[model samples]
Target: MSAPANYPIESVENAARVLLMLRDRRDLRVADVAVELGIARSSAHRMLTTLQSQGLLQQKPTRVYAAGPQLVQIGVAVIGATDLRAVARPTLERLRRHLGETVHLIILDGSTIVFLDGVEGTFAIRAAERTGDRAPAHPSAAGKVLLASLTREQLRERYPSSRLRGGTTAAKKSRRMLEDELEIVRSQGHAVNLGESEIGLHALAVPVRDSAGNARAAISVSGPSVRLTEDKLTEHVPVLLQAADQLGASLS
Candidate 1:
């Protein structure tokens, strides 16, 4: 095999080196970073300040720096996404085969639902490709299932006001209405979207909970409303629930 070509950019390489140094040491100082990188103190200070601003580094009360909350979040997200995709693909494929509808694995990121992976159905017409796309939480079945997992205080913090955007006429536009819907979702152990996130799309979702019963993700099946009627959706609920349970157990 040919050796990989090296394209080293000086500033980026130095910043990466600094980050690696901080990985083994906490409460780092700019002078320490400078000494380790063999760079000027002023340059080290500038790099540290930039990283701190972006939440990669945090300055302590004692004037030392450590990894910030954003960095921790990024790390967790990376690990979780990798593991989830690997573990959930078989279940997602099985659901698609059983239901003949698009299957999706999703997780909530802040106020939005992110599609981590998906399997297209056998039908010619199917739900839109959702992998790597983010949609507002209020209008998606997967979003509601995931949102219902949060505590009341967390819900309050996430949606403080009643005014919210609607993706379609079926979508909840007010926080009060959304909260009421989420209460039903929690009680029913699932959520439904009938032309809410997109016109003519119907979706049903159930949470994949960990050992502690906290929802870590959601698995959903979606298709055109013409074929995915309320009766069909209700009929498919047990299948989705079973797959979700199996996947959750494996994850736990």
Candidate 2:
């Protein structure tokens, strides 16, 4: 199809605008681009086509667009592949031994949790069968602890009050309940998961703050409640807290 009359010329200035628009969104559809710039759909399509051909934009299965592999490759170089795993390995081992359960180092990526690394205990039965998994912020142990570090405004932006959904059927929490839980988290400087993410899984987590005192990630211990009794969790709290304190001591 031909470019629409409303399309800005294929000049360096307009190309710069194209990059800016893409930079602002993780995903954009053809219609969204047209509406944002007051351009016709055909014009936006042509621009997207050119960008895709040149390896700047990628079209998903649903035809929504995101930054292409080229940009991801560039991002890899710029982000320097920081090895948080290496930095926290010894700490995780110590925490796992103290808790006698699986310990996780999870990073908050956007409103979701990314399990960057995990150390499974020697126990025969464990709750989380996943490593390198991702989960929503409101439900998971590490996720909530990290979420609690953010401000109420940030929580609203990430998990809006209107769309709040409780965790698993066993441990359902409404928006107000979650807000209350967050307040508790802020007060204790730790978060608890009582079969919220999964049935029979009990977890406790503390924020792994940086040298700047900002919670960048969380360290969590999860296990089967039978072995991971309430008393066990209470006993392990100080251990987890101290380990997190050590992890934050170096990274500014």
Candidate 3:
């Protein structure tokens, strides 16, 4: 037996296609959209203009269009509504237990990292609950792991200026510095924060990649710098990588 045929509204489908294209391409010109959709330039312009008017897209000075703030808001809402935290909690708990340090699941939002969930360690003094808190990306292990997943073009689009919002004396202060750090993150498949986000705190993070190999989120273990020593960080990296792999598999 065959399934019944379904109907899709042409304009709505076209708009959704445009959105998907923008997601993969990062930015688009009307001509690019036209070629992708096999639509006339005028029709593509009309669609893009409508999307821009509705705040789903924005045009840059270069005349290329990218996702607008409204789309990002919608994405955040969708991510919030998803069961990603629930899906990741088991692995997070396991890592926390094994490391005896707080384990966190974080996602990137623009140039910042938002803590979605966390598992506290058994230590009398450890990193506190950071769930729902936001922090600058360049200063956190989770943030650097997430940022390392982006292409250079995407990074430039996100940070057009060289100067970055300072988080601490240890934080990367410029795009050049961040790019250099990100290269290390990419090569190592993880990142470490040495009191960059907060004084006397230390963290190590690994990216939880999706099936497409994009860093959908990051898993991190954090504690007081005194106990989470350089040797401890070296010891914890393989364990973190294992947990991240399990979490990514589950997510996929």
Candidate 4:
């Protein structure tokens, strides 16, 4: 038989509840937390500050608490480690077949984009597989799509400086430029890399969102710019979005 329930520690339970609350709501102030938890404002502030100290939460400019990088990283790591690749592989393969280009499953790790898995196209001049590869997030379609999911404060936290760096000259030169591009990605629900990661490469990506409407990963198609021209990349958006939705549903 399974273990029976024991006496619950109230503080620990409250802490867990706070985390759970943050998971659903984007922001919380001390008063909001106190009222919801039926605790004093001082108690709520103490709890929030403690979690912030442990890197489980962050305080925004508006003095509201948001999920911190450590919390997000832990969630992303779990998604990447367990069901993500296995669940996404079939969808990626089907997308590759449909698009006739390399398809990659990517997740954000701070300012980096890690290629968790990929299905390489059969064409002789296709983009290479990038499974287990890490690239600068600012210069890749998959990276930008994932980045666009973050709040403006989160983006600023990730990139504090104006100057940026990447492997290719076409990469966004500053945080301002990157934020602008991310805004476009957010508005369009997709991102594109036209020779931004490499001189002759082009790619397009859409977000694989979880039930909470947060991006857990990105699905991308990449090929040589000669074949995947700007117009062609635009043409692939609808199908890519379909694949992302399929993958997101499976993950959920």
Which candidate ranks first by TM-score, i.e. highest? 1
Best-to-worst TM-score order: 1, 3, 4, 2
- The better-scoring model by lDDT among 1 and 4 is 4
lDDT of each: 0.84, 0.75, 0.85, 0.86
Runs in model 3 deviating more than 4 A are 1-77
Candidate 1 lDDT by residue in tens digits, 149-238: 888788878788768785798799988898899999999999999999999999999999877788889999999999999899999999
TM-score, structure 4 vs. true: 0.69
- List clash counts for every candidate, in order: 0, 0, 0, 0
In model 1, where do residues sit more than 4 Å from their true spots? 1-79
lDDT of 4 by residue, 1-252 (tens): 234349878888788889878534568789988998899999999999999999888887889987775775566477555478778989999998888899998989888887777899979999988564567899999999999989999998888888998759889999999999898899999999999999999999999997778798999999999999999999999999988887787666
For model 4, the superposed segments whose C-alpha errors exceed 4 Å read 1-80
State TM-scores per candidate.
0.70, 0.66, 0.69, 0.69
Candidate 1: the clashing residue pairs are none
User: Which candidate achieves the best lDDT against the true structure?
Assistant: 4
Question: Ranking by lDDT, best first?
Answer: 4, 3, 1, 2
Q: Which of the predicted structures, 1 or 3, would earn the higher lDDT when compared with the native?
A: 3
